[model samples]
Target: MLDSLLPPLNEHNLPYPDTIHPIVVHFVIAMVLFAFVCDTVSYFTRNPKLAEVSWWNLVFATVSIFIAVIFGQIEAGLAEPYDAAVSTLNLHSILGWSLSGVLAAVTGWRYVLRLQNKPQLPTPYIVASVALVGLVIAQTYLGDLLVWVYGLHSVPVVEATRGGQL
Candidate 1:
């Protein structure tokens, strides 16, 4: 069983370890979660004193999204061609990019609205944050689907059989 489980290491076609991909995904997810938490807390607390700090949270999350996009691109580049799971990976990449763009734009808009003292800024901020959370959920789900359903670039398994070396 142990022998069947461990594929011999080779130079030409080295398999990427499963652990790294999920770590990257989790990092991105954490960014989104932190953004949501900060936004929610700020909204409820409504302490004008913390306004600047709360805004910084969104800024930091936006930066993290950029980092995640880089990591996602690297992961995709490392993926093997002919893998049936590429479809989900492709979809994940597209959605992740779209989410990052929207988040960045919204964050910038919020900052502008803050400077302008726009009366309706709060409502738009709330709406944008909710949309970001929804996008995060969708992105996470797509990642899960790639792993569980598509099995993209997963380690190959070997089965033992009664016949000779099968």
Candidate 2:
């Protein structure tokens, strides 16, 4: 009997390579955390330039977070996570969407502050920024648990599932 060999593919299988979600999300995570740092530093140092930098970072991060979320949704479906990973994945997905909205709202507030030419960040905004940092940390932890601990979309996981061993 003659037959063609099956082509190799990575876990979360598709013929071509794909890593868009993690790459975009990580960039967004860095941008948001750095923005918070700049915001806090400017608040303490009274440096208008750093505040300006912080504003731009927030604006870009708000936009990028949406992109990250969209790609994450697509990849998450492709991942087809196992039973153990489902709850974590769902939580991460919810948080990812929620964070996008929260970032946009915070960015809008910051835009108002920028327009008003505020001398320093108000305490309320700073407090909210701290909360945002906490949320980001929680989201990061969930993502880490999925990839590092549960091995969602990893090669071995995919192979086992395909082999009906999972």
Candidate 3:
């Protein structure tokens, strides 16, 4: 019924040229990692400019993650994931949502520190940033497993599922 309301799906089962989730997600990953880099570098160099850079990166990462997760949910729904891919997809989705909240919370804390013009990052913020990077790494691994290992949304996977081969 919903199919009638939308344009035809592509080979990847999306209504557009390609999956948008990954594209947006890469930006989030880059920003998140770069933010951590800036923070760490600032920590050692005592440069306020790097802190400002990290702050902007965190702010953008917080915003872009939501967009990534939204498109991720949409694409995951249309993916027609097979049995082998289901668990990973579900985990990825759960982590994706969890990361959104985590990113927001970290950003909020960072904003508070930024407002105070704190020169050095507190130990607690460093700890939380480390944890956030760990989560992002785990999420990236799961995402890779989904596409590279389980082949979710790949042409062959889509075709096989349609033909009952998956």
Candidate 4:
């Protein structure tokens, strides 16, 4: 019936052979980076125009990050990590959840700044934005470890899992 159009399962038994989390999360990362860059550059250049751009980017990023986290949680649950990969997966999951909250809080603060009489971000908000970038970088490293070091969805690992040899 409806399953006629569905793709066959891969070695990992996923209906579609690819990981969905990475594709969505990369967009979240890019949007957050672009937002921070626009904000920082605008702060220094005194270009009010860039503030509008930055605000929109942050808004989109905040919304997109939740989507990324949801997909990440789903994919991670399906990952079936081997022994050595377990810790990295756990840490990445925790940080992914934390980053979603942090991003939402920062976006809320940015909204407050937009509503201010001056319509300018404060120094503390800027500082927090920079810190957010740092946290994102750390999260990126953990993700890399899972994909590169652990090879979570790599074909060989997938095959092993499917064969019940993992």
Q: List the candidate numbers ranked by lDDT, top first.
A: 3, 2, 4, 1
Highest lDDT: give the candidate number. Answer: 3
Clashes of each: 0, 0, 0, 0
The 10 consecutive residues of candidate 1 with the worst lDDT sum are 157-166
lDDT of 1 by residue, 50-157 (tens): 455556766777887787787667656654534456677888999989988987887788688669854333766778778888998999899888767654444431
Taking every candidate in turn, the Cα RMSD to the unseen true structure, in Å, is: 7.3, 4.1, 0.8, 2.8
Instruction: List ranges where model 3 is wrong by over 4 Å.
Output: none
TM-score of each: 0.69, 0.91, 0.98, 0.90
For candidate 4, lDDT tens digit of each residue in 5-82? Answer: 867667654666588888888988998899899889888887777887888988888888888888788778778898
Model 2: weakest 10-residue lDDT segment is 1-10
Error of 4 at 75 (Å): 0.8
Q: Model 2, stretches more than 4 Å misplaced?
A: 1-10
Clashing pairs in 2: none
**Candidate 2 C-alpha lDDT tens digits along 1-166:** 2225644557666434765877888888898899999999999999999999989989888888999898888778777688889999999999999999998999999999999998899999999999998988999999899889988777887788888877
In terms of lDDT, model 4 sits at 0.86
Error of 2 at 163 (Å): 1.3
